[model samples]
Target: MAYVDSADRGRIRLRRSSLICPGDDTKLLGKMETVAADVCIVDWEDGVVPARKEEARRLTAEALQKAWRCPERVIRTNGMDSDLFETDVFAAVAAGVDSIMLPKVENAEQIIEANLLIDRAEQAAGREAGTVEVWALAETVQSVQNADAIAEVPRVTCLIFGGGDLGADLRLKRIQLGSNRTLGIHRYEYFYAYSRMITAARAAGIDIQVTGFTSYTDLDASREDAEISAQFGATGALAISPRQLPIYNEVFGPGADDLVWADKVLAAVDAAAAEQRAVVVVDGSMVDGPFIRNARFLRSLQDLIDAHDGSVG
Candidate 1:
């Protein structure tokens, strides 16, 4: 476990959907400026071919130079084994990325190395220390086993489930139409892994995100999967296609009914507090410490979304 959080600093960033744009795809990179996803990752790993690694890094740097509408901008660097790994980190940090998505992170040492790399780059660029954060990718069994340790690393803001790669590693067949109907209906077989990471992340007071559901054509399936992730306590979902962004935003966004209930609960709590009462009942349910806390979280989430739209001060 990590140090207890005293403030909202530990609250998860408002990443309803994390969209990955292939670094070498200049067309997709250009479109990033208009995408509505909460976080856009210009990817140098997996999405890019080995021969185009340098080109991809250069493209990502240039894309970061452009004004991005998304609140959070990130770059996913190649794995540690790649010769371009260090350079990718340096370039992404110097390019002023909000965070770096480190692929294939197996342990906390990798996160420490990434943090150190960011430190050097930020210093060399005359930027503040810790300006950039690391989003560690836990896609392998080893990484999942060490999830809690990775969460304890300094500058690690979130742990992302690299489900596609993990599926590959496990040889679990992904969702495909027809013939494999049973497996397709199940879609995901990694809920246990997700729960393990979620438990670890919560213990460390960090955010956890779920990835995979590559069937960009099936918005319905993506929505179902994302809904399951939210139910599993994941803060966000990764989207391989822009088509999935709206689905993630819709599923993760606080609902109207929830907002109404939260508002009522908060007001009732305030009234009770002013009257020196320690408890209250609303909608035939007990409204106490825990309820108040939940209401506050819901209100804060709505406020964040409102702030994003310039609807609130």
Candidate 2:
């Protein structure tokens, strides 16, 4: 059965930190199981060498089956065109993974095809058809254009932006012609594209995750980036190292201040409703319907955090 329905659509929350473990690396796999990430993504795509793809797939399958107390287990498969796609999908199903992350997804048809494959594989294995959810990586121009359709795929639980591949595909250079040490031009365009993808995911009622930053050692920059993405409506972010996990968790999860403010706003809104008023004042600030909605979202985050037994902190 599907993990979420219309009633649980917006309620299925996730924290910012998702640790990406290369499926072929058994050492990393062992380490990731004990890490405090909201999700653990075993990567069978860019992280593995072509020669080791099969081995990676097998190891990832084994790791998932042996994982202890993992909150979420995801497998990032190669693109649909890759020879490893079928193996990755089958392995994930056999191992009982929480979700399958399909990279370089270009449109709705591709997502539907992947889902169909999953359904067939599940039936062949005598498991439920919709047991594993699909997550798409909107990495190409076509994917961005078809973001809404991809998110609306029946078995897709989330859509993630693959920034590195996307920038390369769009021919965005990291150099500012005259300066070797400086950042890239067209930075604004990147942000614009990110926002567009997030908008599409939200509109389609699917969760969204930002690509993992390549700099695994830089926790501060990673945290800041995750926070910015969250502010732009991204539900979570991908992480490459265990060190980055805590930062992502803290930034994505609710804080004491957020809970306190949400409580006050909700209380004020409730009193206003009881008094037959359309507006409410909370701590001398005027609030209305929109503010109430924001409060509810904050409360939802708190509820999710609590449900996870405060692992976020």
Give the TM-scores of the predictions, in the order they appear: 0.91, 0.90
Best by lDDT: 1
Clashing pairs in 1: none
- Please write out the lDDT profile of model 2 over residues 1-313, one tens digit for every residue: 4533554455465646687878899999888778878888888888999999889877777777674444778889888997778877887788888888888899899888888789877877777757688788888888888887887777777888877667777887652211121452223546877888889888877788886555667566666667777788888888766787777777877778988989999988778789998878988889777878888988987787677766534
Model 2 residue pairs with clashes: none
lDDT of each: 0.80, 0.77
lDDT by residue (1-313, candidate 1, tens digit) is 1212323328747888888888999999999987888899888888898899889878878888887878889888888877888898888888889888888888998887767677788888777877677788898988888988998787777889887677677777553422234655344478778889999888877888888466678778888778888888888888878888888887887889989999999888888889998878788899887778878887898888888868312
Give candidate 1 misplaced runs (Cα > 4 Å).
1-9, 171-188, 311-313
- How many clashes does each candidate structure show, in the order listed? 0, 0
- Taking all chains together, the TM-score of candidate 1 against the true structure is 0.91
Predictions: Cα RMSD each:
3.1, 3.1
- State in Å the error of residue 266, model 2: 1.2
